[model samples]
Target: MTERTAKAARRARVLDDIDLRLLRALWMDGRARVRVLARDLALADSAVSVRLRRLREQGVLAGVHAEVDPAVLGLTTQALVMIRLSPNTDSRAYEERLRTMRSVLGAVALVGDFDLEVHLACRDMADLERSVTALRDAGAESTHTQLIARTVAGLGQALLTEEEPA
Candidate 1:
């Protein structure tokens, strides 16, 4: 094997306990300032910065994004749609198509009975119906939908550990 390839492999395995601690800190709070993180992790600021830069370069740190509350923005209607596709269908193609629609917030490729699970945000029941109808017209054999009453947890909060820090 090439020496460059072997060196890259070694570098990948060099992450230690400190790196894991830094990652956990970032995961809990993406907006954490580098200085504060360095203090918390009891490492030098430059060291923390180096680790963060390396993590970003290695693609371990994808991108930091903000989390917004949909309910506060008057998006009161949230629906989970279970779509069943035709036999031997290419659901991914349809999934990509659904993503292009404004109401579709997220889509997941599923196994078993349902081919895709879609999450949608709409203004009301009528809008939800319209969105579902469009999906049906686009080749979904059938869909089962349930209105979300509340969102108890979200992606940002869900990433943290269940137990609070002492």
Candidate 2:
């Protein structure tokens, strides 16, 4: 391998305790200020800032976004739709097309009986039905829908331990 590729591989393996702590803090609260993060983690502000920059540069840290309530935003209907495509169909093209659809919030290319799993958000049941029908007409062989009751644990909590630190 080339020198640049070797250096990149080496950098990927270099996460220490402080780096983990910094990631934990940000995962808990993406909106956390650099000063507050430094104080909470007992590190210098500059150190935290530098670490955050490095994380972003390395593509380990993606963009941060605000969590919005679906009900308040008029998106009252949410469903997990599993789609089965016809044999020999290109799943990647179908996934890419579904991602561009307005009602589809997230899409995952899957294995087993279903080719794609899609998360849809809509204003009501009617809208959700329409979106599903559109997907079926577009090329899905069959589809199944399951309503999302609630998120028991969010991403941050799921990734980190629930127990409080001593």
Regions of model 1 farther than 4 Å from truth: 1-15, 154-166
TM-score of structure candidate 2: 0.81
What range of 10 consecutive residues in model 2 has the weakest lDDT sum?
A: 156-165
Question: For model 1, what is the error of residue 48's alpha carbon versus the real structure, in angstroms, after optimal superposition?
Answer: 1.6
Error of 2 at 6 (Å): 12
RMSD of 1: 5.9
Report the lDDT tens digits of candidate 1 across residue range 1-166: 7987876666557656687788788877889999999999999999999999998887666788787766677777999999998665577678778868988888888888998889989888999999999888788999999998877653554333334446
Model 2 error, position 11 (Å):
7.3
Backbone clash pairs for candidate 2 read none
Q: What does candidate 2 score in Cα RMSD to the true structure?
A: 4.7
lDDT of 2 by residue, 70-146 (tens): 77879889999999986656777787778678888888888788888889989999999999998887679999999
Per-residue lDDT for 120 in model 2? 91
